[model samples]
Target: MIYELNKSHFYKVSHLLTGDLVNIEIKGVVQGYQPGWVFVEHIDHPKTAMIWSKAIDGFYFIGDENNTDFNDYINQFISLDIAPRAKDLGLISFEFSGTSLSWDKTLESVFQNRELHRSKQFTYKYKNIINASIAEIELQNGFEMMEVNVFLLEKKLSNLDFVTSMILDWWDSLDDFFVSGVGFCILYKDQIVSCCISSCVTDDAMGSHTVTLNDYRNHGLAKKLIHQFLTYCRDHGFEPNWDCMEENLGSRLLAESCGYTKDSEYILYHFKLY
Candidate 1:
């Protein structure tokens, strides 16, 4: 039977299952950052008895239900059929099987740069260099650092603030460290202009790392910030990665200009609640 989840219940279960490493939490369940995914707990089932599984393209399932049963759930919820697959790089805790997902080269590049591909001992060196570059650019542009903070999903269902909660949920499932990613913002004349966030995934691996705000467009600020972030990731034994919709030409161009290649593309299925 389909069940409705309240925010508090969702948070309680999601935290019980994924811990503080999760990104998307709302009320109580896991939401998607991209499209075509949902993280939910089977309310009637025991938490410890639950099983989590991930398929291709960030698709995940919770509980001991088999693929056929899960497919039934997907069809019922979204009116679509999906096959399950075994665990892959993006799948953190579970395994299933289906067609492999596709990603472009640029997406791959973003993932690589997400982690700086270095060891922990050198992380500060990388961060200092990147931060210094950002500071230098800010000084040159007369921008001021307004805020620098790290977000930690210590509890459950804290992702309602973002547009892509489900994708964030899936990301949290795979990389526990992303729960504490850092966000940096720069302000001009007391108006927030540029901002970026860094992930905990290694640079060589495929992951999401950076995002810049709008209104600060066309200033090469994103490129500079990303470059510094990448250098930081490299020095700290991590790689850097970034991704945007294929239709986002501006982002594609920026990534390309900054040495990111075109990665493969995967269809994102979105289901809106009535």
Candidate 2:
């Protein structure tokens, strides 16, 4: 029988997570600051497990290979528990760690009748900002820099809805964000055009994310915002980590330019429930 692992037993599944963002979400869940679920085949001595982060729609699998019963249970859980809730979310993403990678085919079998897509994700760690001049870079005539805060969220700027949701959805509330996150943005004509923030935070490290309006893409605003982000990291004694799709040249280039070295790579599997 399947069991929903208690928060106190979360450590049993944690041994399988290696990604910074995954770790951050799991930590937040453990601290009651994030929403997630943990399932195991055996409550007291689980040999198979799955950790799901609600905010990110991510699943991390850890288990023995070819465990038909557990895999069957996962398939049922996806169809019943996950599909209804995740229909609004574009894709459900999955990762495997520890000995679970060997179960790739076993896991994929569960989604055999569905459309499955796979992509490589790279994780980066801070080396040193290559462009020391980033901080001194001046914006062109019409652009300005601003700090992101609750006041900005209160303003409800139509242009910033995406950024606002990115913060609130991940942190769940403004109070949690104020306690665990930091952010900055670039404004063009009083509208936010680009932003950088701690997408995930743990005690000693932060996962960085950047978003620039399509129209503002080539203007270097992302780099400037990242410089501010790195500044905050240095001041607060946090190590910065970046994760991006292997196919995203822009994100990969920005990380390389900013002295982030590729630390690891993993695969992300995506599939729709219905």
Candidate 3:
């Protein structure tokens, strides 16, 4: 049987569960989570048993094999083209591989539109890139580049002009991006032209999310802003980790330019309801 946990002990319960910290988005929620649901089996002694759990906009399971009734949970979580809960919940997606065959297979069958994606993950430790910085570009003569605190700006959080994708929407759902996130941008005429920032984070890793105005591409603004962001990470004791679809060559090249090297590939399983 599964049951919801009291909000008071989320931190305690999270510490008790041993699992992957790679998905920094999920890590932040688990570590100092908000009022999201945390359903677990074996309520009486959850830590003593292999557990199955999911938080809002989070991975379905960790620390154990997936439960048998995941389909029922997905059904309760969403319906055909409509969500009865969590407005602004643009999309909920999960990725896994050989280790989570059961949950992977289950979601593939439950969701209607399934897409198999691949991302070449990369990492850059502070030591390897302390001297790395962005070179000036001729087109950037009138632009200003700087970092901004996402947690403090409600306007930016709700800004529709920049929130073009579901991932950006997910960043907005975060109660506070500063909890485990960072951001930087290039402002041209007070509008974001190019930017690079962490959309999700853990204690030691910041998940990379970067963007540039389509019209401003090839100006090298992303590399400039991201290199500075990496310098900030070096000073703060965090490493920037990245993952993008295998076919996104431009993204791959930008990562390489900023001192990141290919590390591994992940099978990202996306299930979207249209």
Candidate 3 local Cα displacement, residue 1, angstroms: 2.5
Off by over 4 Å in 2: 6-12, 15-34, 44-47, 63-72, 88-100, 103-116, 128-135, 154-162
Q: lDDT by residue for model 3 over 88-199, one digit each (tens)?
A: 4544444333224454465555554546553333333333544555354444578876565543243343332563342344454443555555677777765767766675
Leading candidate by lDDT: 2
Backbone Cα, N, C clashes tallied per candidate:
67, 0, 0
lDDT of each: 0.36, 0.71, 0.52
User: How far is 189's C-alpha from truth in model 3 (Å)?
Assistant: 3.2
Q: In model 1, state the lDDT of residue 268.
A: 32
Per-residue alpha-carbon lDDT of candidate 2 for residues 14-77, written as tens digits (9 for 90 to 100): 5555433344555555445566778888777776777677777677666564666577787778
Question: Lowest-scoring 10 consecutive residues by lDDT in candidate 1?
Answer: 116-125
| Superposition TM-score, candidate 2 onto the true structure | 0.78
Clashes of 1: 67
Pairs with backbone N, CA or C atoms under 3 Å apart (clashes), candidate 3: none
lDDT of 1 by residue, 151-241 (tens): 2233132332331332354344424323434344445564445555543232132233344456667776665566655554545554344
Instruction: Give TM per candidate.
Output: 0.44, 0.78, 0.65
Q: Please give the RMSD of candidate 3 to the true structure.
A: 6.0
The TM-score measured for candidate 1 stands at: 0.44
